[model samples]
Target: MSHEIRTPLTSVKGAIELLTDERYFKNNDQQSKLLTIAHANTERLLTLIGDILDFSKLDSGSLPMHFERQRIESVVTQAAQNLRTLIEERNIALEVLMANDLPDLMIDPNRIAQVVTNLISNALKFSPSNAQLRITVENWQGMVRVGVRDHGEGIAAENLPKLFKKFTQIDSTSTRRAGGTGLGLVICKGIVEQHGGQMSVESAPGEGSTFYFTLPAAPAGAPSTTAEASA
Candidate 1:
């Protein structure tokens, strides 16, 4: 389905790109504005398509699970670093807090990284400029808990239950403004569940929000993937 839909979407995007080119539209102010709008919507369409593909994999249980021994501190730091450009562009402070002796987690590093990146990205999107965005890792009741906190316009009490639902939009006006497929949190929750973890959010209308998840730490003498593959 994506293949068929993307072909036409690509054609539309290509035309918009050419029309919006500054060199070509230099003297056509009205045309340039229209083309710019088209270009932005096209980009949003492409993102939506990508999100659909991800959600399909997740829903079908086809998303591959790669269990690895991942250091809690390093994984989230790298995820945040991967998004450093976005954070810096928005002028937000990015902080990662973890104890020096935190234990490694038994999980898929890449998928976990995706969750971290998504949470931080969402936080950055809603947060005010110059606000502090924090990613903290701590040991909680024998599990490793990671939280992404953002000082943004918090969600309402009634909307909490719909957060992880597929294609959920808390506010249509806000959705149109933000331009997301809304499958991100659903995919994040699916990944965490596949790893036997739990994902949740905490927020109030006036205060900020925190999205956090917990995963079991790798047990002592657990066979590492590298060694298992070799054997």
Candidate 2:
């Protein structure tokens, strides 16, 4: 991730340097457009770095979790909203279907949001334009299951088992086409596990894919704590 950020940072600096030159200023239109692209790439680099740092903290058991009862629907809604622009840009149909009776469970809202965002972002990347991404939350046997379904080029059978491995890209060529550091799902898995959740993916080639995770329901009359919850 650090290496990935440096490329964009270097590009942005170069673009800025050119923009500062008097000759470049005379042809500012094209230069300005390049600067815009550079700015966007810089933001992407920063986001990737943040994800890496968060994942590192999680792995080292240094990440802090503020556990409190939070409405599941609200968390899902917020995550979907965060990715609205990406969804629109791809012309994909993004839907959130939340069960009205979902219980307020103790969790770190930000971490949960990160999980949702990662899953949604991955879905958008692999999915065809105009395909649908469905996010659904439901209560099942005292646990909340959130599933992200994408109608994309589904994972190959040989690659399914390696999906969560850090820096392991199932489709190496597709990584460049998809435009990500490939650590997104690894980070999502670490976050969900820290929150006492189990994440799993179900997919077959050409059949689309669904990634679902389950978080245990808060025990009856039990107070929430920062201590890790068991999956």
Candidate 3:
């Protein structure tokens, strides 16, 4: 499937890149508009393909989890940094708040980062220009809790239950515009659960949503994974 789909798509993307070059094509409004549409659709197709592959691996429980004791804040912060360009483009004000002296979590940092990035990307997609989104991490009881809060047009009560279901996209104007395969949240939930954590959400119509996940803190006197330390 990868070879059949991605190979042609990659070739097409390369072709689009060449056509978009000013040296090849003269600057004309109609030409530029058509190329822009092609470019956007190409990128969207690639993203959907990626989501499908990820969902497949997750469903089969074949996706790797490299467990390590690490700071949750560090993982979340790095994920947010990777999306700096998107945040600027959307004009969204993003803030990360971490509680002092938080305990390290036993998790796969890359997987957790993927979850954080997915949640933040979803928030950014629904958020209007200049909106605010907060990512907070703190100790809850004996677990480390992290949340991505977004002030956007919120989901309905009925739909909140369906958000984590596979291929379940709510029928709303904002959702329609966001354009996702509906696998992101489900995949995120799978990853969190694999790390012995739980994921949930809180939202209402008109009020924004906050997606939360909690992982048990690493046991005291636990040593960091040697692979992680060396990396």
- Winner on lDDT between 1 and 3 is 3
Candidate 1: list runs displaced more than 4 Å: 1-43, 172-175, 226-231
Cα error of candidate 1 at position 186, Å: 0.8
lDDT tens readout by residue for model 3, 125-177: 98899999999999887889999999999988999889998999999999999
Q: List TM-score per model, in order.
A: 0.81, 0.83, 0.89
The digit string of per-residue lDDT tens for model 2 on 1-231 reads: 556756766777676667757774764678667767776777777777776776677677777777877777888899899888888999998888888888768788888988888888888888889999999999977889999999977887788878788877776554568776667888888877877888999998778899998888777786755565432
Q: What is the lDDT, from 0 to 100, of the residue 144 in candidate 1?
A: 85
Error of 1 at 79 (Å): 1.4
| lDDT of each candidate versus the true structure | 0.83, 0.80, 0.89
lDDT of 3 at 127: 88
Error of 2 at 104 (Å): 1.6
Runs in model 3 deviating more than 4 A are 1-4, 23-26, 221-223, 226-231
Positional deviation of 90 in candidate 2, in angstroms?
Answer: 1.6
Q: Is candidate 2 or candidate 3 better by lDDT?
A: 3
Pairs clashing in candidate 3?
none
Tell me the deviation in Å of residue 73 in model 1.
Answer: 1.9
The better candidate by TM-score, 2 or 3, is 3
